[model samples]
Target: MPYKRIKWLILWTPTVTIALWEYIRHTFLLPYLSMDLGNALAPVIVLTVTVTLVYKLFHLLEQTSDSLQRERLAKAAFVEREQLARELHDGISQSLFLLSVKLDKLEHTQDKESVQATAQQIRKTVKHVYDDVRQSIASLRSEPSMTEVQWMQSVEEMAVELRLGGLQVELDWRLTDSDLTSKEKIELLAIVREAMLNVQKHARAKRLIVNAFKAENISAGGFNCTIMDDGIGVDDPALEAKGRYGVRMMRDRANAMGWQFEVGRNDSKDNNQTVGTVVAVTKGG
Candidate 1:
């Protein structure tokens, strides 16, 4: 039952029970019983009955409230998934159509260099679009009930779908014993998805690794998540100009969740020219 309703019930239940007992006794039972004796016996009977009835009613109300809450949540999840599906259909479908037209033109054209470049560009665009659709589907299907381990499993599954040079993902789960709240799991999953999507779209790296570890000099339950890829290093100044909203969005999400977000080039330990990108997030417990 709602708090207000329960409050009112508590206030009025005793009053109504006593008033009914008094009315019954005055109208029909005073002649058979003494006033003092009737008053004591009537309250006992009225109190017992009131207690039983209130217990049953409140139990039923609580059950109904729980059922309604679950139903509402289910409906909301369904609507969100449907909206995501429609957006994917509209965006990816158009891109695929344009890609088909380009492929057809390339097949009929005699120009070698132009045909090769167009084909390569179309291939990259197709892969990026496919990755986007997969990520959207994965996000829509994800549930807050998932635990950290289960969330990581889902991430691995999504990684398999990337199919970038058979992109190998190494997960270093140092914080496996840690417990994360449902909201934390969802937010962390979103950050991971954005990171992986960036790798799929721009990294062009053969290997990707995600490391989860406890953060140093932080409060209890603080942890850090980092994704490293041997891709081209990011240019901080040109990122926004290059229309890379994914990185910005990830940073914004981390900040909103009170996590520290960092993205930059992974310094080469061996001093080789093979620079890479690193995206890291540190969150408090």
Candidate 2:
């Protein structure tokens, strides 16, 4: 009987201690100790509590140290990103400008072979530089500023530029001019631009919607820009498709800007006439 009791006690050791400390603290340790023992034993109690708290304090300090390190690292990364953005915009981006100018001057040349060769080289170089800057810009995700009018001008200008490059372009806007932030405007424009490029390259849509505005529930304030085409729409988004690449890229760009990126075709319930890939972005109300 004694051996059995001892074995049970060993098994219940933790539980008994928990019951004493939690349920029977007054009878366990308080009544036997003097209330005025504080004067005599305050230091010991305080020291015991403080010693236990010291571990928490150390954990807090370690967390603070980690936060400081993270902030420093993030700052360094931002600085580097800015530096790279500026250099590419200033340096290689300028190279595109030069090439454009030289190509312009060569328009009067009569040598078919030379002209073709020169044009091919120009295309190759310009594409390489553009891809580089685009990669860099995509990486940095730099936010540039513009008023509503300026924003319109920038998008239209880019559309015209693309049109001149032999890609069809269209601009249709219903979102009124208001206090849209620089970041918001840029994000929306990026969606339009990516969608346009997708239409040109993947969808093989002859016609394009370069700048389109969409709204729901409220007008002007609560609005989104959309780009729709008559090209091939990806039937399944879960599977990788040509148009989906642009859709996914646009969605990601919008997400990074805290905006909702929406992709749909016009054949559904609300709008079935919508034939091709549609890129949409929502703005503030």
Candidate 3:
């Protein structure tokens, strides 16, 4: 039986049954049965029915709760797997594409210096792919309860890596541990990392800045993270020719976390020249 129907039955059955029993005892059974005997049996009958109904109701509730819990776990696992697949497509796949392009160049080059350079580039691409795979594995093994300091260290490590590539990187982080929830922090970090990688791979800029702060006017949660680079602006033709999966993935991550994602050329103080590109992810306003 449906829980609601059983609950209603349990509530009304005892009262109605006792009322009818009393009516029959007084109106008809009084001739044969004593009032004391009828009254004495009424409590026992009510107790039996009440106990049975209570047990059934509790059992149904427990079963419902357990089913809901299992559904939640299954859904969470599916989402995690989907995210890992996307990361592989965006990170490792892109590196392999670069490696293939370098190999094509190596095949056509005749000069010894050019051939050596192309081979070096291929080696770097292969190393990058290896690192990406290792990072993905590490992420899967990482604890969910990552501290704010650890997150900051991760961002700093990314900046250091960019520096090794000869890009000047700056960090201006102002968020505290309480600024965002654990899931929010994770998604935001992913978006930032994607932006930085795009700059390192395609921006052709000398300097980059990563800024994170609270801005009530710009975000509902008063939180925002921006990646600004003095690279070829967003209007560059080469960017469009390259696939936009990285940008699309970053936008999807922000949207999934209920955040706002925007990418455009930075506003220049001097209107005569275009500046670098800027990518911002903000808590939805």
TM-score of candidate 3 against the unseen true structure: 0.54
Report the number of clashing residue pairs per model. 0, 4, 0
Clashing pairs in 1: none
lDDT of 3 by residue, 1-285 (tens): 554665676578789878877888889989998778888988987777667865676677677667778999999998888778776865687567557656766888899998887788778879889988987787754534565226676577667657755688889999987988787777787678778878877778888888999986864566878898888878635444557778878878888877788887775732343448989887856
- Residues 1-285 of candidate 1: C-alpha lDDT, one tens digit per residue: 565677578567778888888888899988998989987887697779677977766776687778879999999988786556544543364346446656766787688987887788679769867876776667645543554246576566546445422567777767653556666776677678678767766788777788888767767878889988877777778567656656766776688789989888877642343548888899764
Off by over 4 Å in 3: 1-35, 47-63, 86-91, 97-114, 134-189, 196-224, 227-249, 255-259, 264-271, 275-278, 283-285
Q: Write the per-residue lDDT of candidate 2 for residues 1-285, one digit (tens) a residue.
A: 243444454455445544444444356657676656534564554455445654455556566667778999999898776557454643374446546744774686688986886687678668767766775667555434464226676467556555644556767676555645566666676566556655655676656764545556644545667777777775655325653444565666677776666776655422344466676676544
What TM-score goes with each of the models? 0.48, 0.57, 0.54
Quantify how close model 2 is to the true structure by its C-alpha RMSD in Å.
10.5
lDDT of 1 at 84: 67
Higher TM-score: candidate 2 or 3?
A: 2
Instruction: Show pairs that collide, candidate 3.
Output: none
Model 2 earns a TM-score of 0.57
lDDT top scorer: 3
